[model samples]
Target: MPVAPAPPAAPAYADPQGSLRASDADRDRIADILAEALAEGRLDAEEHAERVEAVYRAKTVGELEPIVRDLPAAPGRTAAAPRPEPVPAAYGPEDVEGNADQLLAVFSSTTRKGRWRVARRTNAFAVFGNIEIDLTEAIFAQPLTTINATSIFGNIEVRVPENISLRGTGTGILGNFEVTSLEGVDPQAPLVVVNGYALCGNVEARPKRGKWVVDLQSKIRKHLGH
Candidate 1:
C-alpha cells in the first residue's frame, strides 16, 4: 500500500497579533534558533541559510512563526514567544575573529553595517576614497573595541549607538577629526576607542537615531484622536 509522508507539525500556538512589527532582536533570536537546529543536524547548511535569510526579510512576528515551527525552542524561551525590543545588530565573533580584520578604501568607497560582528581591533583605511563604518546595527565581540583609522585625501564616518561609551583621540593634518561629545552616556556600557590620523580628509563619529515607521495602529490612533 502507498502511504503518504507524515504531515508537517503544527505551530505550538496561534499568532494573535501577527501583524505586529518585528525588531532586530526578534530576527536575531529566530536566527539563533535556526542555527541551533542546523548544529543539531535537524537542518542542512542550505536550509539554514535560506531560513536565516527569511528571518531578516520578515517584517512581522507572524512571518517568523513558520520558519521555526518544527524546530526546538531556545533555552529558557518558549516556542511561541512575544517579540522583544530591537537591539543592536551584532553577533559573536568567535568564528570570524582574526578574519577580515581590515576595511580598505582605495580610490573607491566601502561600508560595513547591518547585523555584523566587529573584531576586537579593526583597521579602517581610506586613501582618496570614502569609508563608512556603521556600528549602530552591529554587535561587538568584546567588551572593549578599538578602531584604528588612517585617511589621506579621503573620508571616514563612523556611527555608533547613543547609549554606548566612547573615547577617541586623533590628529588631522589639513583635515578634520570631529566626534560628538559624550553627554548622558551610560558609564557601564561597552567601551569603544577610536584613534588614528587624517590627512586632507575627514574623520567623524556621531550617535545613531531611530527612523520612524508608519504602522496601521498609528493610523488608527490618529483617526481616533488618541
Candidate 2:
C-alpha cells in the first residue's frame, strides 16, 4: 500500500499565563519568528494574521506552539518589538489589552439591558451575548463582522447594516438567527443556517471569511422520547 502524505504538524501554543511573565521584548521575539514564516509564504496571510494576534494573546511557549506550527523559517528576520525576559504571575480579563497583544475582547455587562454598539477595529472580531447587543454601526465601520452566540442559555442578539456579507451556524434551538440589511444576496456569498438537534440552546457563528466546522457527538435520539 502507498503511504499518505504527513499532516501539517500542529504548532506549539504558548501557555495562557505566559503573557504575565513575558516582557514586550519577549513578545516581539515570538512575533518575529512567525512574521518570518508569513513572508516566506509557508503560511497564508489569514493564518499569519491569526498567528500574530495569538502572540500578544499568548503567555507561554506552549501557547506559542500552535502559532508556530504554520510559518516557514526565513534566513533573516528582524525585530519590530524589543525582547524581554520571562516571568510568571496572575491575570485578569480586563488586563488583556495591556500585553500589547489584543486578539479577542470580552465585555460582560447586565444592567439596563439596552442595545450596545460594536466598536470598529481593523482586526477580526466577534460578538456573542444576550439581548442587550447591537452593532448596526459596526457593520458599516468594518467590512466584515461576526456573531458567534448561544441564545437559549443567554440572549445573544445583533443588528447589522447592509453591504457586508454574513454567514451563520446554529441549532435554531432557541430564537438564534442572523439578519442582514436586505434579502437579496449574492449566490457566492450566501447566508448559512444550521441546527444539529434543535435542542434548547445553540452555538451560533458568523465570520467574515472561512467556513465553520461542527464536531458534536451525543445520544440525542435516546432523549427524543420516541
Candidate 3:
C-alpha cells in the first residue's frame, strides 16, 4: 500500500453532526478488505463482526492501536530495524497484519487532530494515529493482542474488555496515560511494562493467583522544558 500525503492542517469537510471530518478513505481500505473476508467464509460471523468494529469505529491509529497490530508478515515485508535511539521517531506498523494468529492491528500517526470509535468487529483490525474516543457503547478484543503506540502531544483513551492476555506496554515522556483498571493486567501473560511519564491510567485484571514472582515500578521525572 502507498502512503498518502498528510491532509491539510485543518480539513474542509464536515459530517451531518456539524463537526469536522477527521478521517478519509485510505484509513478504511485495510479494514474494508478485512471485512470482505466474511463473505469468503475465511472469518466466522463473530470474527467478522469484531474485525468490522475494530476497523470502522476506531478513530485514530493510537486509539485503534490495540485494535489491529498483529498481521501475518507479508511475504515481502522486512523486519523493522532495531531502534538505536531512546525514543524512536515513530511507532510504525512494522507488523501491520504482520502475524496470522494475532487477529487485529491498527497503524496511524498524529500530526493533527481527529475522532474515532468502534463500528464493528469480525476477525481482527489494525489502529494507528493520534485521536480521541468517546465511550458511548462497548469495545471488545480477541485473546492475544499487540498495540504499539506513540503520542507526541496528543491523547489516547482505551476502553478495555474483561478477558485477554497483554504482553507489552511502552510509552514516552511526551506521552501521558490514564488507565482505569491498573490491576487488569492479565497475570497469565508475561507482562512487559514500560513507561516514561504515564499518569491516571489503571488496570483491573484477574491475574492468575500465584507466588509473588512479579513486581515492578519507577518514579518519573518531569522535563524542564516542552
**lDDT for every model?**
0.67, 0.35, 0.31
lDDT of 2 by residue, 1-226 (tens): 9999999876565444444365554544555555444334565555645555566566665566556643333223344555432211110122223222112223443221123323222121223323333332221211122233434334333333232234333355454444332221321121111112222433333332222111101111232233
Worst 10 residues of 3 by lDDT: 215-224
Over 65-158, each residue of candidate 1 has an lDDT whose tens digit, in order, gives 7888887784334656654422222224443334436999999999998867777667899999999998876766644466778999999998
Model 2 spans with C-alpha error above 4 angstroms:
1-61, 65-77, 80-132, 139-152, 159-199, 203-226
Identify the leading candidate in terms of lDDT: 1
Q: Rank the candidates by lDDT, best first.
A: 1, 2, 3
Report the Cα RMSD per candidate.
17.0, 19.5, 20.6
Listed in order, each prediction's TM-score against the native is: 0.50, 0.28, 0.24
Q: Which candidate would rank higher by lDDT, 2 or 3?
A: 2
Error of 1 at 22 (Å): 46
**For model 2, the run of ten residues with the poorest summed lDDT:** 211-220
Off by over 4 Å in 1: 1-100, 183-187, 211-226
